[model samples]
Target chain A: MAGERSSMSEKLRVLVVDDEALVADFIADLVEEAGHEVIGIAATREKALEYLERSAIDLAILDIRLKGRLNGIDLAQATRAREIPHMFITGSGDPSTREAAEATGPLAILQKPFSQERLVSVLSQMAQRDHSLN
Target chain B: MRILFVDDDPDTRALAIRAVTHEFPNATIREAMDLTSLDEVLQERPPEILVTDFDLRWTDGIKIFDRVKAANPLCCTVMFTGTGNEELAVRALKHGFDDYVVKGSKQLRRLAITVRSAYERNNRLRELGESRDLVLKELYHRLHNNLQLVISLLRMTEKTLGHESDRQQIADLGRRIQALSALQEEFYRSEDFRRVNFSSFLERLARNLLETSGGRIELTAELNLVELPVDLAVPLGLIANEILNATLKHASPDDRPGHLSMRLEQIAETLILRISGDGAGSGEDPDTAKTGLGMRLIQRLATQIEGEVSLEHHAAGAAWQVSVPL
Candidate 1:
């Protein structure tokens, strides 16, 4: 089964959004290695909205605690409006922020210091679920 | 040196960052609401000295200082905790804490001032970092104001040349210089002390220029971005003022519209500003070889930033392109 899953095609299209450039790049690298195509990376809410409007990415990985005036809660609201699927990756698991993320329906919240393997597995699952829904 | 505040309350952390920064403005102050964050802040920006509280959720202040000592024995340590007992403070000092303070409402103000004064005295010798910045900031403002006064005097004397255009030009340039100086004064007065966010700054600059424009042209801007420092924001604001004045003066009333638009941009490190309008259909570019007061002011402001200016006259209107490297 693992071998069959590895050989599967129709590469997953992913968008990684994080304010920190290094974290965004790391997510992109991990996603690509998991047989998915990383489309683009955005560091701001405006840029991410633009990407969502124009692109056909299968799923997005949003970091909760962003640098700008808008945080993950704001981005999730935007995604919900468009009915886009997303999972959150955060350096923090604070109760308030976790509650906010949970109110947006079923979301996979992964704590920071996460490994590349964990990222690939979670994103791969999200991409597959999105594909089946579409 | 590093001062750490470990408490579950956000107020305490903020109070600590403010109080410690006030005491040793140059020293790196890091706070942790808990030990984990304290450890993280420490790992990122290590302070020369360490301070902690005895009562923490995950770890005690004693363990925190011991970790600090283990990481670097040279780091000075101070422990202050409200819930902690004397045994903890004694243990912390014995291990590595250079000083200890008890948190109490009774002696709160006294304890704070004491901690602050002690921190200042301990770091007084090598703590000239912020003092240097303060002196340099003072020097910058003094130079700018002196230059403005000199320019104002020259302008006042020049207006008496008895030529309408010369007097108008002199007054215009005078206002532009004054605007620049005012912006400099305001910038140093800001909390950040070096940058001006452009949206509100430009709005005020436009209002000031319109007041000085004698009600000829209505000024408006469609600003989309913010966050430019004093070096660029002040000159950009002045350049916009001068450009608007020149366009209004040179254009025929029938030929040009009563309003001009100034749009600014900050694309990464490159800042671009465009001033465009129907120059009363005269086809004359105000930003040209024919020198005038506004032209001279724009030139000076542009050269100050080592930027370039170009004049473009299209069918719809004329526009000035100003680009600078930040």
Candidate 2:
């Protein structure tokens, strides 16, 4: 699967947005491990949108609850307007949170402590879906 | 209490009327000599108690008992039988007749006692049944909610866990939990928690997998209408989830579109499940395809249901077939 992925025209350019620095870096590492390039890791909505404006990111992984006034769901809604496909990584399973996240039609929702296998699997699948879209 | 007495023989009819009147002085009794009169009397006023001779002129007492029970489930019925009709009386009792009284000069005296006791027993049984249903419904509700809670906690843990190996284990555990949660949700949707409609259950399970697959695959199902006991449905659902995850993981090639298909049918006494997907199996050893935690789990689940799992590679894709006792 990795070999086939490497043969693609380009590695997926992924942006990671989360309030937690450690978690942000963790997702970046996983994205890189999955053969995707992490353009930037944003700990706030402002920084995340800044990265989106600066870089051509193919995908985004947003944390539902962020530190700032605008959370990951807000970022997701913004991404929808940008026509950027994204997924969610969240620590909470509140229905309201899930509902808001789902309203974005995310590629996938990665719960905390998600295994490397799941991350790679989902990212690659999302990459394929994104590729077909392009 | 209003009682309907049906007996073709006038002498036996008179006997029953005397016994019932003696038992309850305030009771209003109606008499029917044949099936026509029985139907008319039933239409006029359905009885709280129906005491009738097993051998009627037009139809047997069993038919009358069935009619009354069908029209009004709360109606208590007693089938009066002669000496040689004892076996028939037992059969009627097994078929939901409240009780049966043997017809004889002396034994006929017990008819009124049987009628009164049976009616009381029927009322108590009805109350008990309603209460049991309420309790079962409450228990199912709590069980469903608790299962959702566990899945939520697992999902949260999956997001936070650091080690890749540990996260994989948690992810696997989470999938199993989700499978159980799906079953509970199905139970909530169903009126009978003891049996699951296999076709609908699998349809929902397949759609759920498709939802998480990121639209990279097209899923099609050919399912037979089969109802399975709750015990079998849970493990079978888990097995389906495991195999689905495996297909989503391995079968999807980076370049081409992926297709996953599932078919379930009952052949003879065995239930057969076939799940196949376009993946890496072409030109690869079928034996190697079977070497995975998913395959092992499938095997274990098959054994749990007294079945076997087979992994095969065809020209188009890889497939797993599971055959279990129905």
Question: lDDT of each model, Cα atoms only?
Answer: 0.64, 0.75
Clashing pairs in 1: B2-B49, B255-B280, B256-B280
Highest TM-score among the candidates is held by which one? 2
Error of 1 at A98 (Å): 44
lDDT of 2 by residue, A22-130 (tens): 6576678768877889888988888988987777777888887675233888889888778787888765444556788898999888655343446777777777775
Instruction: Give me the runs in candidate 1 sitting further than 4 Å from their true place.
Output: A1-134, B1-77, B80-159, B214-216, B229-238, B251-257, B279-306
TM-score of chain B of 1: 0.53
The Cα RMSD across the true interface for model 2 is 9.2
Query: How do the residues A33-122 of candidate 1 rate in per-residue lDDT, one tens digit apiece?
Result: 777887789898888888877777666788776773337778777776776667886654335567888787635765443333346666
Instruction: Write the residue-wise lDDT of candidate 2 on B1-326 in tens digits.
Output: 88888888889888888987888789888988776777787788788899887776688887888888776778999888774476786798888888888888886669889988898898999899989976765565345434535654665686798898788777778677766666765665576878888778778767666655557778888998878889899889888888777776666666456788889999999999888898654222556546767667778888888878777767777788888887
TM-score of chain A of each: 0.83, 0.86
Model 2, which residues run further than 4 Å from truth?
A: A1-134, B9-15, B81-84, B105-108, B162-171, B184-197, B214-216, B226-234, B250-257, B268-270, B279-292, B303-306, B313-316
State candidate 2's DockQ: 0.03
